[model samples]
Target: MSIRHCYLQALALSTLLLFSGLSLALEKPIGPAVLRISGLVTQPNMLQQAVFDMQMLQALPQHSFTTQTPWYPEPVKFTGPLLRHVLAAAGSAGENITAIALNDYRTEIPFSDALKYELIVAILMNGQPMPVREKGPLFLVYPFDSQAELQAATFYNRSAWQLRALQIK
Candidate 1:
């Protein structure tokens, strides 16, 4: 073949290969149990503990507390991992995290509260897994009974239930 034709053919092949690799690298993976909401998971960092599936949250050492809230008639028993642990897992270090629930309910939580309190992303209630109707899968809960300061209207509004995504900002 002519040298010019060969050179052009090689250049086109290289361009195709480079573009193909880029596309493959950007493709996301899907699994039965785990969901990749956004970004990529690198080495297990401080924030690895921050993100959890329903099963993973249940498997971890459970923390339970009875708390009274306007939503319920009686004090409720909440069970889940401390919010800080989850934030640590996600390697999050921000002033606020915008939480989005399954039903698209969204709220922003201050990082200070997560660091100071035993706020948790709860998957179970009263020893039973919560369903969507019952606010299941995940719920951002604060130890309202432990600290009267957390029982205010503002904190109650930030407690997002059936949480699906948390974007740090």
Candidate 2:
């Protein structure tokens, strides 16, 4: 096979996959689900809602940032996918989101916040998986250190720990 021929074949296959909607597929979670997103989402084969295991969240583009939070005494590095990326994967250009915690705490966040800030659904803290007692499994955190305005009461209140679900609207 000629190199040019192989290149042409590869391009054709990729174009076919893209047009067939294979490029937009989101697989069913194989591990235990850690989070659920519903209301206004358009995930493949699961329009209106999506379940995400730890690995599913990790599969998105990952980002990390260190910030001092009121919940902690020192600045700690938080690592996970950006909230915007998660929303994109769910096919939601959301306007409002209700973040639900494991203990039933709920907070309303404007979707614009995700677009404006480096908000993250944090899976790891300080290079280690956060324990439940330490506010883990999952946490929605803002990049407080990145901007002075983010180090405020409003952002802290929106930073829901033990985050379990996000209801987009």
TM-score of each prediction: 0.70, 0.84
lDDT by residue (tens digit), candidate 2, 33-130 = 89889986667435457888998988877899999999889999999988877766665554589999999999999977977899999999999998
* Candidate with maximal lDDT: 2
Model 2 Cα displacement at 163 (Å)? 0.4
lDDT of 1 by residue, 37-132 (tens): 323222232233233455544444567888997778988899887765554444345557787888889898876677678888887788788887
Q: Which candidate is the best by TM-score?
A: 2
Q: In model 1, where is the ten-residue run with the lowest total lDDT? A: 22-31
Model 1 residue runs over 4 Å out of place are 1-51
**Could you tell me which residue pairs clash in candidate 2?**
none
* Model 2 regions lying over 4 Å from their true place: 1-23, 44-47
Each prediction's whole-model lDDT (CA): 0.63, 0.82
Q: Each model's number of backbone clashes? A: 11, 0
Q: Residue 44 of candidate 1: its Cα lDDT? A: 30
Score candidate 1 by TM-score against the native: 0.70
